[model samples]
Target: MSEIATFAVGSLFPELIDKEADLNDWATEVERTLDLIPSVSRIEIDPPRGFMSFNLGDATEFKDLIQHAIPIGGEIRFHILIPARIQERIKGWSVSAGNSVEEFLVTIDLSTTYPCAFIIPLGEGVLRPSGAVIVVREFLTEELDKLGSKAAIKLTTLGPSPFHAEFHIKEGDVGEILAPGIRVSRAISSGYSRWTLHYDPEVHESAEAARTVIIQRLGYEFSTFYRIVAHRNIHRFGVAAIEAWVEGTLAFYGGKGLKSWIYRTAKLRKILHDISLEILKVQLGIEKVHKQNERLIEKARDRNSKLALEKELAEKAELGFRDELSSYAEMVGVLESRHSNTTQRLTSFAVSLLGVVVGALLTAALRK
Candidate 1:
């Protein structure tokens, strides 16, 4: 809380400006100027990350668009912010838009002190966000068209970057962006709600483009953080409460049984308690039922594998046969062949002996 700054026009509710005092150092200046009540505050946690968009059609209408942009809840679209969020880039070379300059110090006045979003058309337009706009061959919107992701695919309808537009919001730097909504840092660095961010000015060497860059960044941050905040706010304040209240109002509206109405109120009370518990679980970062199921699955798998191995060993032991089945079959065939050979040899020997005796007797008769 002691280290952040907020928009100069925001409500007096808990804001980031109380922490910032006077900022001579640009790095600490945004934070220092937090004293400007209602100004945007310091970025709290995580190297910043989120979506960005630019929605000005072209440069010809810069003045009109800038006027519109100053008011809260104004319609802004089709501006380049980060990683291809815009469908079109304001034409850099076209006569309709001014030349896209690279690297310079810029200051567009959207100060709540003046209650205006006027681009300070001074000595030179403040253009540096670290450096002047890097006039690349293609605008972020046009380049993103070539990508296959849904974020890019949806922006194909956006024509081009606006000649007069917001700057890009980035992971670490904060400026040039404003808010009629809430902004939150990444969720990981959750505790101790205070932090600082920095960008290299010397390397960028273009301060004039600061407003456009910061405004673009605000587009990205707002798109990301505000959506989440809105959802949470709605759930916390709208859907959850409305659903509960509707049930109550309907039960009592026009008419109802006295006892039934009492029971309904009691039920509503219990539901609110339960809803609060669920919200608490989410806030506490304990809401992952899927992980709980995965843990159970892992435990079951471990138990099953152990059981399967044990069962296999038990089956092998139950048979308890020492001889291999194929070896025993081969032994049986060999014994049978040896027995057949021995029987054949004995029969042949007996026949041959009988022939010898017959021959001897014939010899004796001839001699006589």
Candidate 2:
């Protein structure tokens, strides 16, 4: 079983920052960087597709021979070929470093991609892939940091995996900042944990994206373990021990590795978790809406009850007013009847008095 570890450095720009004018310098820097790495027995620049050959000895030789070969403002890639003997040496070193591995192959790739460089160690049943990865990562980081600092160039996003971890640059030098550490670590850890629950070896063969994500997570863990070991300086076997422990734990937990285990178990867990959260949110929303509706119903009932009470009062007041008016009209009618009777009596009495006076006057006139 061949195992591979990768280290990548990206977004490196020359002080001049002009790809066209700085082509020569860039090539020189790339060559110099490659030279810093040990066990690089051969280097092939711009090999034919699917084939590799090396001829250049120095930057000038490569520049003169391949200047016309590369187009203007085009990208450059270097394929480093390490001999089997060198790989054996690395394997020996890894085993000496506490890994239970006797053989592995290491390959370094320098390209124009986001991860400009990839350090890959390939082997089978390699007990500690991460040990080899960390060694190379440290070496590459140190060399790149030194070179970048000297040239006043900034090397951003330098790491073994494409987890978006970056090296900050300040004052034309690489700063001690690992950008995207928190976010990338979280994503990688979550991915690895999910994969542990559901990983299938057959699925890994076909699922390139899934494999890449898982491998990147592994690389991230490797780097993190390296940092922790280097910081504490107390752990025995360091990265190798950590890698073995992590891999063993995953393999044990994965159990009877079915092809659909990862997809079935991890994905189902994620789905169920998501659904549970959504249900919780929905239930909360329902409760909120229910409470609001209850409040509205209570307000409506209160308003209706108030209106009913007011209506009842108005009806009672109306009846009372009507009764009072009827009573007052009846009293006035009785007074008018009494006044008419008195007036009739007085008129009859006055008429009788006038008749007596007229009769007495007529008698006096006859006697005269």
Candidate 3:
């Protein structure tokens, strides 16, 4: 399993693209940019949908803008009210008021690199991420002009085409689907409509493969820095690694899956914060181990100093045979010289006493 990087490509693939080149291009970008990590939370798209006005409110207006953006894609409509009715006058029609909030919530799961997409034909979308609501509609409109088509939709992934899903109807009186890709015209049998697709499996596989590569990189990073505790520091490395991998993969596949990449990033930013804290603590412990090593070095230095002092004393006190013998010879010579001087003095004193005794004997004979 470790040997095969793209082992499971051909299996469980969906059809979407025709040409291998196009599929690969799309796949590589989508994979590299998105699906690297499993996000911890769900994403919510809150569009202001006014209620009780008998009218499609702010959310409907923005939905209209997105619809116009798509050249020939499918459409989106909120079935807020059915055919309306008026008072007893019977003059004209009036939309019956309903009690509902003015915002639409679209919940997205961040774990899969899968795609949840639709086209914005009419234009305005105020999409934002995090607790802060951003001016997403204006931001996308400007970018869409450069991209040529106003048609856009969200997807868990763009790789491996035919990545399909069903979303909840925000405010509807009837069931509807916002599908951008090809679907069959078969009528619902019993209660279900069969949507068919003619797609290339390789494109899906290639894109999935690219996503696998990016995810592997993320795993490597998460595991490698699992010990790092601080969220701020983790961002310094983690965010950059994610960005680099995403960019490289996209570039390799011809820059196709940029939209999915943005959506995925928006979803995962907080997950990184949570996991990073756990990892930061782990890394801090490792550093503490390194500090213990320094203490061991200190102990070793103290031991070496004591041994050095003992060695120095032994060298200073060592007795050399040649030098010791010479010192002994010098002491013996001085002792022998003093012995000869004492012998000469004793002999001179004895001779002088004998001379005095002979003179006394001569004086005694003269007296007799």
Candidate 4:
């Protein structure tokens, strides 16, 4: 195992940070330093043929949402130096860096704007498969003692586990550092390790070098998280739309219910149309962000870095994205087919109703 020079521990917040007040409330000093991270708009990825664009609706509506057609997040927004009480307990915390010792930087930054997470330095350790996890556990245990359960939970939503960790190694092949052990792979599945390796000292000097990678990594995480939530959202809407169509179709079979049937069917059609459009818009936005990630993969410093990134992207990213998109597309197709069948039924109902009304009117006039 190689000795880690320095490392950082952080967690991901499942929710997107999009409130204007939260965005505007960033500490100026922290914001100035973080302004170095790239903007989502400046990064662009050309969609392949047939990936036609759709309207993102009004700016006001999508401005703070992911549906705004841009990939935003991956920067620090708020931070505070270590508190005196906590500092006293862990003041001299250090971990071995081969023959030497490296002091920990124990400040906490509540990264709020994009890629929302809590970040702190975890000092140095032997870069093993579970090295980061072990260090973070000890660190959090001590922190929980100092901060107290209520306060710690209130300040940040950090749990017993972190979403991911960044291991900074001064030497060794990054690919190997990132590789999962046989036992760990069997336990958690292969090709998906939560810790990542990036060049050290350099990352400390200016995180700019690792910006693309960091953004893309967070992008992949957030997108994957989003896909699950999106599936639920689409599924909920699809089910409701289908229910409406079914109810409307049944109403048509009831006598003296022509107007009610027409109204319900029209409403169902509108709901189906709206949900289908929403699915497409989300798909478009996700594709654009993922394309940017593809470009970022090529920016890796060496062949090893590139290979590591490509492996991660292939194993955990691209397919996941396509799977989510394909699922959404399938839902759309099913809904569209239901809509077509419902329309044909509505047409038949309308024609038969017209015939019945006309015959009754003619019969009444002859009797008069």
Candidate 5:
């Protein structure tokens, strides 16, 4: 019996706060930073609508950090490629550990927008002879973090919330499964879990049965990451708005006068706009996840796998975008009403002051 095992870890790329820069600029910066690695040899930047692939140079210096269960050969030169717009345009990329010692290659799919992710595939050599998968995952994560610090790119150590990894096992006895071909673990507190796909090599040579499932699940992972990021942004803006509202109300009662109120009100308005954008982002994110989950259900290899996906989708549905939207809308409505009421009061006060001035003028004229 022969078993082929390979895995890849995915994480969200932090939102680059530079508003003025376009996609090209961001990609270029990533390219420049990654090039700083001594082991990275040739790099290709994706065209206006394409991908980048490059061969990994000799990384023997860091070989000691990885506890390999089986000895590896060659200098660990791996090729990496990303598919453009994976769901809509591409079928998905095959990322095997490599055929021979000298010909390792991996295809990583990345999104260009929020919830953008980076996947790093591990060679078969790294996971052979029953290696500790978690330890190797941690090893890669640590090295990525160090690379980020060394290159000034913010690649994740633990990755963003809802990080996902997938294992493809072509041979070997796949432990107990809830389905014919897959076993999905429930996400933990950190939103981390590894889903395994076991394929009978005889039925589908090269494990082609898992391709559609892979694309759909990867799509789900990306959407989940996006949703989390958007949700977090909403919280960030909501907190800012709350602080502004509280400060403004307290300042007015504490005799801080109109200046403080005006400043706080302006700040609150800006925060409200930010909150609105985040709300929209989350809405879009949820839609994507919903669609991908449906696709996963359709392509599920077995009854239990479909049921598991459905259950997961149902749990995700409990998050309820509608409720979130309503809550955010209510918060905005309350703030807007307060602003309107304050403006009306200010206008009335101004009119009353004008009346006092008119009365004084009339009295002075009469005296004259």
Candidate 6:
């Protein structure tokens, strides 16, 4: 039977420690450093959150090196999983270390034959464990070394104290030796064990390819969530919002139950349905407004075209009226000239008759 152990580490960076601390660059450095570890077979990086997951070939060898670093005004936590074969030679073991600022505990299940599982809960935060481990180890090794000494002494002493307990396991009751403050539903079964320490939930793909796809999806979804939330105009929540909530819940609980998963997914689906309806309404309203504007533009063009045609007809009518008045004036001038010639002829005829009468009267007087 193979054993599976899970560990989590957290770190807090001071606001002004490094003004130029780029998360992507920090992730790259962590990836490179973890690659040098002999047991690490694979290293996965979450750049936006500065999170990383390391798959080790033999986790037991580096067990002692799993130490926490303390920094002034900053906190760092480390979580690691080690799978070891159970043998008769070793009896039981527990290790713990803490100060005023930080605390940690590690315990092994002695009663279980093989395939035992353990969990370490780190508090809620956004910084990645890889970057936390690397940066804290480099910057605060002195503080970590002091804590490491206490852990070593505690492991060697093995005294009976509140922090340490011994238990006997019955045939079916594996929960007899559960560590303090650790709660789990079932025992870790014997098989090829897989461990994932990440900040996002991904779609189910092939077992080998799933982690990569999940990390990519997580980054995308996280970014989209922030973008949507920042915009005041967007009132509807969708898949991105749901993903953010689920991710936070999983991170806080450390991925515990099947029932919680079902509830969260169903809730997300219902919200998405409502948001879709809202989007459809917005689209329809926009289309209606566009149609109204188009009709108004067409009406204005038609009115302007009718006005232009009316103006042209009015100018043509004015020209026709002017030409008819000029023709009437020319006909009046010809009639006036003919009437003057007729009056002159009548006056000349009357004068000739008077002249003949006067001549006859003068001739009769001279003969008498």
Q: What is the model-wide C-alpha lDDT for candidate 5?
A: 0.42
The TM-scores, one per candidate, come to 0.21, 0.26, 0.14, 0.44, 0.42, 0.18
- Which segments of candidate 6 are over 4 A away from where they belong? 1-19, 49-368
Model 2 misses residue 26 by how many Å? Answer: 0.9
Clashes of each: 66, 11, 48, 2, 0, 10
By summed lDDT, which 10 consecutive residues of candidate 6 come out lowest? Answer: 156-165
Ranking by TM-score: 4, 5, 2, 1, 6, 3
Per-residue C-alpha lDDT of model 4 across residues 1-368, encoded as one tens digit per residue:
44444344343222212333232233332233222322201222121111111232343232223331111333332222233243334423323322122222222322212232323343333333223333433444444345432221212222222333333433322433332210001122343244434434433343333432444344333333333233233333433444454445444434267786566556656655665675566566556645644554443323235243344344333423445545655665665677679889878998999999999999999999
Highest-scoring model, lDDT: 5
Displacement of the residue 57 alpha carbon in candidate 3, Å: 54
Q: On residues 140-248, what C-alpha lDDT tens digit does candidate 5 reach at each position?
A: 3344466754543443322332234344455433644443454434433333345555654454456444533544454444444443333333333434444454445
Ranking by lDDT: 5, 4, 2, 1, 6, 3
| Candidate lDDT (C-alpha), each | 0.28, 0.34, 0.26, 0.38, 0.42, 0.28
Q: List the residue pairs that clash in candidate 4.
A: 73-114, 74-114
Model 4: CA > 4 A from native: 1-103, 106-264, 301-308, 314-321
Residue-by-residue lDDT tens digits, candidate 1, 52-167: 22232232233211211111222211111222122124332221242222221122222111111211222222222211122221332334344323221111110111212232
Q: What is candidate 2's TM-score against the reference?
A: 0.26
Q: Please report the TM-score between candidate 6 and the true structure.
A: 0.18
- C-alpha RMSD for every candidate: 33.1, 38.0, 37.6, 11.7, 13.1, 38.5
- lDDT value, residue 90 of candidate 2: 49
- Model 3 scores what on Cα lDDT? 0.26
Candidate 6 Cα deviation (angstroms), residue 328:
99
